[model samples]
Target: MLLKSIHHSLDELICLLDQVSDHDYTKSCEALSNATIGEHTRYILEMFKCLENGYDSGILNYDYREGNNQIQTETEFAKQCIVEIKMGLKSENKTLYLEKVINGLGIRIQSSYYRELLYNLENGMHHQALIKIAILQFENMAVNEI
Candidate 1:
């Protein structure tokens, strides 16, 4: 059920992307505080990437997840990333550790794959909402379809 929601969110993102041109995808939106749609998309994708990267290692640290600039600057590459992420989404739910650094201190917490996946899904949705706002700012694009 969680995976299904995640996939649906991803599909909605793809639909939103389809309506956006490369120029607009990378263009800064005033409504988004000058952040590009691609930037948000990269952020959303990277959360899942972080989870997937740490799934086997049992150590998830979002801060250390490598950022892929290409995914943010290139619409096609970003779409391909979504495809790859969807393909790699399956895994048996198991204990996982989430690591984060705050105020110069590192913190680790016990978590599970499903729990992290839910977090990613929620995070993606939050970004998607921001993306929707960004989409609305464009006069040329039909934002209602998304």
Candidate 2:
């Protein structure tokens, strides 16, 4: 049930991306201090990828992620990443170790794959709300509410 909701959120994000022009997608918004919609999208996708990596390796570190510029500006690349994420989510459940840096200290907490997936979904939605605002303000585009 959680996976289904995450997939649906991802689909909604993709649909929103499809509606925006590439120029607008990459355009920096003053409200966000010149952060583009693509950047937010990349952030959201990378979080999912991080969760997947954690599930595979038993250690999830969200602080360190591959900084792929293409994932930010290229819509198709982001779409591909989404597909990979969906596939990963459908895999067998496992224990996940969530690593977080709090007050300059590293902490590890045991978590379940499904719980982490829920985190990713909620995280994506938070970013999606920002993206929606940017889209509405910067470009005359219709964005679906998440």
**The candidate that achieves the highest TM-score relative to the unseen native structure:** 1
Which tens-of-lDDT digit does each residue in 26-115 have in candidate 1? 999887889999999999999999999999999999987668899898888898989999999965899999998889998999999999
Q: Over all chains combined, what TM-score does candidate 2 have? A: 0.90
lDDT (10s digit) by residue, model 2, range 13-82: 8888777777777999888888999999999999888887777688989888887898899888888888
User: Which parts of model 2 have CA positions greater than 4 angstroms off?
Assistant: 138-140
Q: Tell me how many clashing residue pairs each candidate has.
A: 0, 0
Alpha carbon lDDT at 76, candidate 2: 81
Residue pair clashes in candidate 1: none
List RMSD in Å for every model shown: 1.6, 1.7
lDDT of each: 0.88, 0.84
Worst 10 residues of 1 by lDDT: 137-146
Question: What's the lDDT for candidate 2?
Answer: 0.84
